[model samples]
Target: MKPLNDVIAACPPSGIRRFFDIAAEMDDVISLGVGEPDFVTPWRIREAGIFALEHGYTTYTSNAGLPELRRLICEDLEKRYGARYAWDTECLITTGVSEGLDLALRVLLNPGDEVIVPEPCYVAYEPCVSFAGGTPVRVATRWEADFAIDPDAVEAAITPRTKAILIGSPANPTGAVQPRAALEGLVRLAERHDLYLISDEIYDRLTYDDTHVCLGAVPGARERTVVLGGFSKAQAMTGWRVGWICAPQAVAELCVRVHQYTMLCAPHVSQIAAVEALKEAEGDVREMVADYDRRRRVFVKGLREIGLECPEPGGAFYAFPSIRASGLDSETFAERLLHEESVAVVPGDVFGPSGEGHIRCSYATALPQLEEALVRIDRFLGSLR
Candidate 1:
């Protein structure tokens, strides 16, 4: 038998899932590993899907998704972030941000093209670029720098092979939000180098301290940027798998061409539900955001009190705390914490080498769970010392 495609085979499985699997086999395990909101999809949004199903709307949507949904998405973007795009040709509903990321890379990358990615990012970014036949050139972002991308470093890494810069804000694992100034610098670099910007904005509405600065809304960025967002993090609709891509008309057309052959279309019921989410769920989203903000403050303070140095997470529901003082690397620390304390966290190194001394703990769980997890973590650290 022939071997599988080397690239696909070589791609590492999600690092976040290893601890998840371990936790599943044990009782009384406190998991802060998965990067998903604990909240269920809002009642109104779920009802929309149920209504569609009862109405016999189980068919596939158009390749670009329902027209009304696309228009509403465009309006949401413009109203929330000041970004503008056409619903007909410039917006495409995808299975999730995962699919949108893949489509963006496939459309833009040729074999051996290079994509600049900042380290300590989401687990999928590098592998997605590699699977798309592009080289993922990583630039390091330090814990000391709050994991923000340094545009000068990105500019220095560019060569003739460099084709794009991929970025996720309100980022997973790190929970770092790139400020407008940092993004402005990146946009200028992209323009000067004639490179594309793939902006992952899935957690746009999950920020706690500061407003999420949409990369596409930055001056001179909208034309060259592919903005990927979805109903998962904000609307708690992860299982719905409905996300969208907004890009320039030419790039978007090619994405649709590829998507039609591969995905055909996003689920019809999910599209209907997502429309309701965008339309009628703002209050639900606000309430969830407020709850997460409370959890974030309590969780970060608890981590510091436990002797782990946690930089405050400005956005997203994760806290990447440095565990170097524990005298164990990220993988070893996470494993021991799970077994000894029954508290589960993801090893930061799985994100990149730059994340070596840290572990990612998501604060999306209920406050009582977070508080209990912190207590267990403190005891675990005491035993280690």
Candidate 2:
């Protein structure tokens, strides 16, 4: 009858999904396309979910999520990053960081507002901002600068319509962790422009070399920063779809209002599981992070040996290496790599134009599969030459 909303219609489909669907059909494909962790949810966490179900905890949680969870999240943030978030008024549990991002944008943006996003970023960042009735202004981060967004570039992009700055450290597509000085600079920038800073910290616990600085923890940032985090990446709880948002009181209250209408609340059982994750899964998280670090080293070394120029990814389980020497655009590189060698990866260009000559290879898969994928990639590169 009526056409769908124009904004929804205009949003592009996920670039990662194209190769994911192809890999799903192919019998022996080795996929490095998705950013999900391969680890199973810790047994304790899963057991908690089962216990909740057995006790008939199937009802919707409070719109802000379980009180215990919010408290634990706040304590954990303070203990780890020196950030202070009040569990009562400053934190709201969400379906996932995806939902938190959406809710934050909805609460903060009015029609025609602009959000400055640095690329190559998570696939959903730009579209989510747009779907919330904001304009996404993409500022390119250079591979030469290790993909860290420059504060100067961010400052240059701001205009009167600019409303917020969104950033992801230990970023998707490119595993670049922003530096402390850079994050502080961003805080200064936000303060200067009276803009909200949305920091996606899903990979906070997955960093390898440097500690992740919680953006809101930077001096003078608490009032203007919204911190988004989740159990999906670090706790390997992707299917559970549990995450949280921490912001100043007014912003968090508004986000809760939006979330209550749009999401109602995160699943009761999943929230219980997340509580257990925060309580007893610290050892499991450490082991998984150690495993990812090992894989990151091995994968980056393999790519360099195979003639691709890969900067060592500092965090996250991804390695975004330049395939420029192969004389193919990222889309073609990924397409041929999958068809010829059955190795599926996300083409970098789908992230943004700056990603055109690169590809994102996730090392979150097992060691044997990663090794096999490397061999196939090397063979593919040889064939290309």
CA-lDDT, candidates in order: 0.94, 0.94
Q: Write the per-residue lDDT of candidate 2 for residues 86-153, one digit (tens) a residue.
A: 99999999999999999999999999999999999999999999999999999999999999889999
TM-score of 2: 0.99
Report the lDDT tens digits of candidate 1 across residue range 1-385.
9999999999878888978998999999999988889999999999999999999999888999999999999999999889999999999999999999999999999999999999988989999999999999999899898888999999999999999999999888799999888999999999999999999999999998656998989999999999999999999999999999999999999999999999999999999999999989999999999999999999999999999999989898999999999999999999999999999999999998899999999999999999999999999999987
Estimate candidate 2's RMSD in Å.
0.8
Candidate 1, superposed: residue stretches over 4 Å from native: none
